[model samples]
Target: MAQSRTTEHCVQMPAHGAGQGKTAAPTPEKQLNCFVRCIALIERLGNALGTLAFTWATVVLLGGYPTALSSKDFRYATAIVSLEAARMFSRNNRLDYQLLFRTRGAVRPLGWNGLTVIVPAAIIRIVLASLRLGSHSYYGDDGHLDKRNPGDKTNLVPSLNIFYGMVLGQGALYIAACMLDIFSFIPQRSLARQGGYADDDRLLRKISGQALTMLAMDSVNNCLTMLRETGYVFIKELTSIIRVDRYRCVAASLLRSMCLHAQQELEESDQRELSYALREVLERTLIADGAELEIFIGLSSQICKVIPEDLAKELEDSHIKQRFVMRLVDVLNSYTEPSPHCPGIRRVILEQAINMMEHDSRYTNCFIDRHMAEALSMVEETVSEAENYSLFLGDVGLMEAREPLSSLMARAKQLLAVR
Candidate 1:
């Protein structure tokens, strides 16, 4: 009877499987992680392969050629290739802009960067030919040779022409690949036409400031990599300057956008949204404290410049509006230190202040004057006999004195007095 009862007992299992009614997958986050990993992998591989190729080419050609290939030359080539690959991969492969365009039957190309390279290369080639840089130099039967041969020199002109042609040829191909990328940005016909040609400045507007800022950082890092490969101090500095400028431009633009958003919110009588936007702008400006303040301040100044004087007056008249200015001053203090003509971080802060001052006579005459005076005082204290210039970008530490760093405090007070 017990055996009969046991035989009737059933063991059940779900048909679907474990986690059949599982939680939703983190599809977006997972994809983002994968994308980032893929990019990093590609970049690493490109850098390694590019350096190796350049090194190998230089070594092999040094013995066989009259003029050895310089590290700078090889590095430049590698940088061009690496950046080109990255731009292409980002635009077409990863983003799937091509596929999206096909659905709509709208496609376009970007040719600006090619023009950028070609123009520079063309000019350099012209200068080289005029100066006869590689003339009278050759690799002959035995070894390297330098001789004045009129006929050879005449023939060499064609060779030089060919060299320039090669440079342009490479530039052209690179441009073609870049043009393929244009489709990604040009989704609608109106958007594409409004965006203008590849070389047009309007293209900058299509990219968000945050996106541009990220790109700027990447570009800087790439430039550093280039510097290590090339070992040319001048080029490295040039790249650094460009990177810095790019950051400033993006930051400033972002600030302007934020201000516009805030203005729109105010116009719509959406106080909650206005407050949210203002808070966001303030947070961002403060976050940029570690960097130069030019972008942040420049953005503020730009906003002030464009808004009607009556609105500006209304804003200044209100406590809420004054809070915005105070927020700016606080950010400026956190972002910069005092210096003549405001180099580095100071330059950005001061430039923005000056720009804002230029727009309103009252701000120029009163508000900025007071703030400058206060800032000067802070600077004086910061640069007393002890000369606490050790720390920069405004990360002041605690004082051991019970009286609380009188000298530093006095400098700050003095700055206020001056203003």
Candidate 2:
């Protein structure tokens, strides 16, 4: 990978001596300056067109369409007039900042921040032009009018609603796009603050932590917004789809993919705590209930397979892994129904799997062994419950299997290792 990726790129010119023959010169700065001037001119032109559109509307009302300009002429003129105004604001750098103000609170990090601003701005202009055309059509005649007394224009107040609608619609689009525009400078800014304020390790850790935090926040926000907007429709749709085994399989697979991504990023990062935190967040978000406990296990197993044996041993020995597993088991158990064959009973099974995976692996540090043993014991109890319910699952699916109270009690002793 390159050392740094800049948002704006400039081509380098070949070195030239004082007497170099007719060498082409660098013009990036000149080009940028020209772009700024063009944007300013567009904004000024837009303001002028807006004024002209307003004037035409007012004059059209005072004088009938036949008296001023033909209906078609008015429509075309109004469209052109509104488009210029829209173009002005769309090209203005300040408009992008205005869009982001709701979330980021009036911060101008990078001016307009590349094409993230350009696209919506152009669309807004097109929309404005359409609105102006529609308004003129609605208010003005199709060139057919009574010569004696044309229809009154005072009833054309609804025509101005175009401007109101444009602001609401285009403004919303601008804000939505701004939310999605992720400039690379966010992490860069945090990294820059590292000097003197914090040591390299601490700064890197914080940067990594914030990255995970942003991911969590963005995911939740997007999901909740989608749910809020289409929750009722989706509920009906899900009712039909949830019954299909294939749908469940597809959903479980997608969730596994998301979890795998989180795990991989955490594993790659040098900050162990941040990685563990991300893993915990994933578990908490996706595995809230034991509905897909087996899928979680299968995915974790797959991820563990890809991990290097030596590093996996170090990871297992570290407090990060054991602590995350313990917390996960605890949360899983709390949500697991109390039955011998209930998946909560399978929590211990996962612990055993984790232990088996780490058992032969040696840790250079002895202190980690105690925590590992404690985590294993917690897993053992959960597994003992599952053992009692295995007989029930022999006849029924694991989801439907529930252990008898007496069997559960009996299994508790084995699980607790009490004679």
Candidate 3:
């Protein structure tokens, strides 16, 4: 019986050497395929090396190292091109090529995007060049021009030239690159909307949506920088001349659109990843300058709804929940006086808190037992005076604040009961 079974198994399994005995000659097509793959790998490596070399060169240039390639003009040009390439790489999500292929260490934390690094580095180089050029006049001892006599309003020429290059040339290129980044999502978004791949397209839609959201954030940052740098007079006269409401309206609309798109595309798993990423980023941003708080709050609100219990439990286990909650509380506490924007942010926080409570019963007891009193005290203090309430609720629209406040209070009661 054993011999019969062995014979049956041998007959069922094909001979391992059968194909080797009848080897077919390699074809031209097969050779071409191998050649193409080799070329692709080489090209990928070359691009990676070029990016690293440029990034290192940028750092060296920033450090004021006197290299053979360190001419002012060359540095400026290199900075612009390198920054543009970095932006392009980030937009295409190719920034991970090096990390994936070469790195042995754990992946870097993710809140700060490529723009945070590249844009500032480029701007610094340009500013340094401008300052250096500005310090000396073209009218030097070589019969070029005259030296400054008690600062004669400083040499405006070189400074203005630098400003023009940064604003017009490099700035235009950055803007164009961002627009292209945004536009690249259109085809993917279209495919998602058309249901081209049905459930399989969910991940694609989430990725594209996230990319667009990041691009929008970068664009907003760029615009804010432009306004801050160029519109000093406008900023001074902001209250009297410019209607803050109009600017707020436009910003809110843009944020709302991005949030809606991102929320629509995200699956539960996507939400978990996004939550993890955003929290890390938020923690970093809060520690840094906190410039991206508005965008962070907007996105957080969209993703905070109906979180999966498993994800909530994971976050709880990892202590992310406590950290995030504390950060939100800190944000709320920071705005001592009522601002137009504060109400929207507060509403989102309350909504998110309430969602957490509903999704995981443990969250209510955990948060309320630890943080409820402090959080409520901060909110109460913010809205304490009638004038402040009027501003907060009026700016937020009374109808909008009513529901969130009610829900938040109800959740608070539940937590209080548990405690």
In terms of lDDT, model 3 sits at 0.39
Q: Against the unseen true structure, what C-alpha lDDT does each candidate score?
A: 0.35, 0.36, 0.39
Q: What's model 2's lDDT at 28?
A: 32
Alpha carbon deviation, residue 352, candidate 2 (Å): 13
**What is the lDDT ranking, best to worst?**
3, 2, 1
lDDT of 2 by residue, 293-384 (tens): 44344334434433434335545565355544454445444533433323333433343334334443332122133333344445445443
Distance from true location, Cα of 399 in model 3, Å: 10
Please list all clashing residue pairs in model 2, or write none if there are none.
46-84, 348-383
Candidate 1 vs candidate 3: which has greater lDDT? 3
Order candidates by TM-score, high to low: 1, 3, 2
Q: Over 4 Å off in model 2, which ranges?
A: 1-171, 176-331, 334-419
Give candidate 1 misplaced runs (Cα > 4 Å).
1-296, 308-311, 317-322, 336-345, 368-371, 374-419
Q: After superposition, how far is residue 248 of candidate 3 from its true place, in Å?
A: 18
TM-score of candidate 2 relative to the true fold: 0.25
Error of 2 at 146 (Å): 17
